[model samples]
Target: MSEEKGLLHGVWETVKTVVYALLIAGAFRTFLFQPFWIPSGSMKDTLLIGDFLFVNKMAYGYSYASCPSIRIPAVGIDISAEDFCGVFKGSDSRLFGSEPERGDVVVFRHPTRGDDFIKRMIGLPGDRIQMIDGVLQINGEAVIIEEDGFFIETYEQQGPLGNTPMCMNGSVGIGGDCMKERMYETLPNGVRHAILNARDDNPRPFTDNSGVYVVPEGEYFLMGDNRDNSGDSRVPATQRGVGFVPLEDIVGRADRIMFSSAGRSMFAFWTWRSDRFFKAIE
Candidate 1:
């Protein structure tokens, strides 16, 4: 009987350790760094599908983890904490006091369903943002674009073509269809980042039909670097795209890409793309 009791105690201790470890990990993920996966091509050529990234939770401030909350052991969930933290403690602006600036890559909850979304800030409160003739302009000033560098393209032929010879700019060396246009964009606050534009087609009509929207206070306008393809604030509010993200809806800021994979199938370790790993999100 004593032996059975000892064995039971050992099992309990092991379970306790596992629970404690999980709690610690959850706390760390909630407060410090959280991992997210890119499931869409909206930010393509910048962040690809199957890319795993780390978001810096501290970039803004604590939301709920820092406050007191009721924790259930077996359930592994926080019951309630917002009210205990303070009326507006976990609300929005905390003492840390950092506001989302233009050009800063941010992750916020979708206004429609509260799902997390990652995008770059383009327009701030009171800023007039309009896309004219395919070029992004802020307050009637055209955004500047500068060339950064170029890349190489590799190809393989199948069937009767067999293995085709790789070509460069003309027919065999660096500068053919591989040349990509890179530009530097400076935000209203002077924050600058490199942006890529690969589309050669003329700019489509501005999808934003709100008629010269003046961003209201406590809200922001966001757009993906793949401007031509992204569904952002520029779209009408009636649509499913992000119309405007409120200050409180922001979850955190994307700090860096931890790991990335090119093709689908998460289980295929051999298919992981190593080149994109640890790449900073510009």
Candidate 2:
């Protein structure tokens, strides 16, 4: 049975190779970078629903929760990590890397929720933020806003037919366009970005005017590019909106779009967003 012994040895070697490769890949994803997918329109006009990007984990230093050094079982071989670490502080600060700057797009763990979220950093520690009649004011000064045109997108099969947020002004995208209000907002830090005004000047009391919030140290205030539709710092996390984000929760900054596909599966080549691929997230 010498021939049978040889075949078994060859198979064992192949399995070992695959396991080693996966271990290396897992370490890279946990320590250096991680792929992230945009699943909602919260950061619309900048980050689309089908957009894929990389979150630079190294930019914010290592945190237990950011990328827990864990293992994945491969081919019956338990590549178990002996040590796993993360932070679960009621409030905490960064461990090593630089702090998140204003206007930077960020990904973080939801303070009181189960999933991770991506949003724009609008207010830092000790900054006063408010929205008055659809205008954003920071530290008692109104941020600049310039009206642009409209942001239109085709409704996917999952989108509702009418009387919904996506189907704004029913038959808008199909007949003509899903006319969403567009504006270029300039942050206090001189960072300018596009924001969507889906509500068409209709101000919701809860979000449109949030009666001045003075951001506390070790926390941040975030918002979405889709101003009217996003559930951001303006709404409490208890209500499914991201509340004051603790600094320790931030995972990384999203710098560019890796690739995107309109189809439900990543393998759908026909639905690729070629134009947005490799595009820098501004």
Candidate 3:
């Protein structure tokens, strides 16, 4: 009888320890940082599919959309929220940081939908943006782009499995030679990062150029590194691309890649991208 009680007590203790650890981790992820995964090629070359990184939650001031899934255990503070402007126009805003700057790879909730989107911050408040024939123009001046040679990698697509006989997410390097025009683009704020130009493809008419768009106050213009492929601020929010993202919707900045896998699926453990582990994102 005593042995039975001891065994039961031991099991209960183990459970309590795991629960406590989970609570601590939940609080940390909620308030400080959280891990994120890249699932699309939009940020390709910079952040590849299967790249897992930790977003600095405090990089920008904590918006109501900051911790959208974490509920602080025991303290009763629910950081998990999509929008905190409850029953008002703008009620709960600002937690830390001042304003987002150009060149920062940011993660934020979709302005219209709650789905998360990550893109590079291109135009800040009051900045005029235009894209002329695949070239980015800001404030009436073109963003300087210097060719950095060429980049050839396999295109492991992200979609439903078993479709076109192409390599899936976990198997990135299995496809054919996918070549792209690579360059270093300097933003107005002097933030320089790599952007891709698919020479084989033409910029889509809708996203390539239309008219000058002046970013309204408290809003920003974002785009993906894969210039010709990304669906960004150039597209309407209702259509799935991120329109002008509000400052209040930004969640965090992607600083570094924790790890990367080449698998088409998250479960493809065999395709882990060991070379990309702990790589810093410029």
Q: Which candidate tops lDDT?
A: 2
Over 4 Å off in model 2, which ranges? 68-93, 158-176, 201-203
Q: What is the lDDT of candidate 3?
A: 0.77
Model 3 lDDT per residue over 90-128, tens place: 534577657888999999877776667889999898989
- Per-candidate count of clashing residue pairs (backbone under 3 Å): 5, 2, 9
Regions of candidate 3 where Cα sits further than 4 Å from its true position: 70-80, 83-89, 155-174, 199-203, 266-270
What tens-digit string does per-residue lDDT give for candidate 1 at 18-89? 999999987777677776777664565567667889777778776542333354557886553343443653
The worst-scoring run of ten residues by lDDT in candidate 3 lies at 160-169
| Higher-scoring candidate on TM-score, 1 or 2 | 2
Best by TM-score: 2
Residue pairs that clash (backbone atoms under 3 angstroms), model 3: 61-96, 168-264, 169-263, 169-264, 170-262, 170-263, 170-264, 170-265, 171-264
Candidate 2: residue 175 Cα off by (Å): 6.0
- Each model's lDDT comes to 0.65, 0.78, 0.77
Compared with the true structure, model 3 gives a TM-score of 0.84
Off by over 4 Å in 1: 64-92, 147-182, 196-204, 207-211
User: What are the TM-scores, per candidate, against the unseen true structure?
Assistant: 0.74, 0.86, 0.84
lDDT at position 239, candidate 1: 82
Error of 1 at 86 (Å): 13
lDDT winner between candidates 1 and 2? 2
